[model samples]
Target: MGTPQTVLHVDDDPEMLALSTATFHQFDDISLLTATTAIDALDIVSSHSVDCVVSDSLMLPDGVPLIEALRRENKDVPIVLFTAKDWTEVADVASAAAVSEYVQKAGPDDLSTVLEHVGMLVDGDRDESLAAGVSAVTEALADHADAASAASFSLDENWELVGQWVGDDELGIVVVEAIEAHAGLPAIEEPLYDYIDADALEELLRPVLEDEERPGIEVRFPYGDFELAVTSTGDIFARPEPGETLY
Candidate 1:
């Protein structure tokens, strides 16, 4: 509802990509920039004034090491480290480096909490209050499982997909429950690759995934337009325009 809040997410797991995108998209003020590798994350940090930085501490070749590099430049911005291993010892270093929060990878709950903390920090709120708010949201989401569906959707406009996934309706309330989810985070990008001319598609679409086929449902590029369809098994189909081929 406010000015768009940009959150830079660094992780390699596809599922975390799905979940984090889903969670952040729920907030109208949030826009997500995803980096699959630590180097990519650094590139984003160098260019973007992100409101929050959520980095998974296990990216191979340079995992949490990237955080130190990020700190060298953007020391004031909030950074949250997500790690599977205990970080009690590293907490001191992180504190000295000015990290806003440290989250253990217990599951989605912790990641969500870290995001909330980052948001609070961006708003100039204290970490203690932010932590309390994160706990309340996590607990409320757990308690209201019956009333609200755990699944959600997110659209990566740059990636050219609108993602939607749903969770089990029959399962009981659980914190950070993994549900059968689906997302369109990268579907539209796939079609661009299948186009007759990559440059044409890039110039026409300008990285915006909009209607290509008909009115609101189809995705169209400068080189061609195609039908976008998805099945329950996660297969994506692109019915290309005349003279265009996927291969």
Candidate 2:
């Protein structure tokens, strides 16, 4: 690892900050920095070239406000909301701020999720490949405007099915189908509601895609064994969950 990825973790709790410091030590590629308040975090970000920011929702000024402030400092820096609060509590505000990812704090294992996202968001190697795949998928959709059903394309050797082009009316259906296809299930045996709230996902995505102000923003979430990346241009890409190998 040449220049290690710099990650700034913000939380008012000393225990949580210590926990994050210890957790990040497990990875050689990450250089972790801790800030107990949004002010210090912003200072750290402005001084250093931070790759990602992981913050708690219940900080002195709240996580979303910190995110907004960080956006002013650096518009494209990946910010992850690592909070113990329920997602519903901060989903709207976080979405509006364009948080790169959200991980609910549960057990110690949840820190691993935050680490995975940090790696995913900061990995420059993957960005080029993902951008290429998105471009191909967008062009394919443009070429086949008359198609009625969702079409899937392989993203890479690791991905089973990558891209789907469907209008807003069929986005949920295509997403469900993509998940089922990637998991090799005839149908989702578990309740569909158990995976993710389709309505909420659509609601979260509509404004991001429709808004001309925010360009090149993509919303990513874990869906079953796959991670779905919904782009600002109405393209969806699914691949194996981070750190998971598909057999």
Candidate 3:
């Protein structure tokens, strides 16, 4: 058989890289490369003929330098951002840089979604891959909410009424409500984003913007003693340790 297609994933998180590594085992016809930074990713592109790059937006500050660098060098490598952060902050940047796809990092299904996109890219179908990624992500978020509600807290039970998206609302406030809603307590007056270090978090979400044509993005991150995940579709998944307040 011919050699397998090579894919590169660039991220600063070792755990994410490890997770992707484990996820790729299911795809036998692919080769993988891991890089911790944009500069490192570029070096790999120089040495290897990478067919596609699955990356996190935070590989650079203002925008995705890894994608820009590849484009600057005229490598024509297909690029996608597979990330846990919302894509709005860097949406304009990624678009301007001509990224191929944007797939949310769902920890479980992210690899499969990325693989689908990469397969399309390899077939010279760019728009199809990006569109597929978006559709899949929207469905995945709704499914995740349904699964969580069926298994655990419902709106009437221990869940709080945190945030709601009416129109053109700020994401930070939405996140705050998700936390308050999860802890089974009334909404706290404090700005929740203030408590968390949002630099890295924002870096991940910088690429996602509220689009009229597409569903908004979701973000999952750890803060203090609680696990948190939020979607623009009004689902905030949270779990707190015993004897700890989630907000």
Candidate 4:
């Protein structure tokens, strides 16, 4: 058989690297390289061919942002952000950077799933084909709500929400109401609220009605069991805690 594909695992934590190495070892068709720093990992990438890079968002010693550093070396290389929480913050940056994938730094099983997807993509699997099977199902569910009508929120000068999204259902009305309530004024265009954050976005919501005439409200999402407080400046933001489930 040909040599196994190589996966570079980069993180500042030694235990995480060791655990990942042991986990991937179960698959005989894979080889792993562990790096404790972004510089060392970049060196490895320059010297050896790497199929995928599983990295942390933050590494020590100048604390190079993992995604930014990876983009400099290899833009096309598939990178997975292994993090504890703050999915919104990472997702926002990743989306802007067009990252390949992201997985929570929770369990070995989650890591395994991330590895499996990366391996398949690197091994010449079509992205659409791989995503189609699952994306279709998710899209179908998403069809339950109009994307145009999706909820939003108002933010403050610091981009913090003064309240939360409150409504009868998952429809965008909730988000609209939430923003309306916090802004104390009607949204410019649609009824739905807006999303804003400095690092991570924790809540998606509907603004409240008569926001200006009433006190700030706190909207809650039953799906993730998270809440948000919309501010008056039309910016809604949240700071995620480690180990918090975003989705």
- TM-scores for all predictions: 0.52, 0.48, 0.48, 0.47
Candidate 4: segments with Cα more than 4 A from true spot:
59-64, 124-247
Q: Which 10-residue window of candidate 4 scores lowest in summed lDDT?
A: 140-149
TM-score of 1: 0.52
Q: Report, for every candidate in turn, its global Cα lDDT versus the true structure.
A: 0.51, 0.64, 0.60, 0.52
Write one digit per residue (lDDT tens) for candidate 4, span 1-247.
Answer: 4567788888876535644554455455668898877788888988988888887876436755666777778878888777786788678667754677778865434655666576675675433333433333233223212221233323334333332322224434444454454445543253233433312222332222212232233333221222343332122334333355433
Q: Give lDDT tens digits, candidate 1, residues 1-247.
A: 3477688888877546655664565455568898878888888989988878888763337344667777886876778887675787567667666777888887437755766666676664344444544554454334322221211122123222223222222111110121111222232333334544533322322111111221112223332334433222111223444565543
lDDT for each residue of candidate 2 in 155-210, tens digit (9 for 90 to 100)? 44643333343243555776677667656776346544676686666665432112
In model 2, which regions exceed 4 Å deviation?
A: 58-64, 124-247
The collision pairs in model 2 are: none
**Best first by lDDT, ranked:** 2, 3, 4, 1
Query: Among all windows of ten consecutive residues in candidate 1, which has the lowest summed lDDT?
Result: 171-180
Between candidates 1 and 3, the lDDT winner: 3
- Candidate 3 structure quality by residue, lDDT tens digits, 1-247: 3467788989876535644554443344568898878888878988988888898875455455666666675447788877776788668767766889998876545666777788788654443434444454444434444443443332334433333332234556556655665554554555566566544444334211232223345565555566565543334555564577534
Clashing pairs in 3: 86-205, 87-207, 87-208, 88-207, 88-208, 88-209, 89-206, 90-206, 90-207, 91-207
Candidate 2 lDDT (Cα, 0 to 1): 0.64
Winning model by TM-score:
1
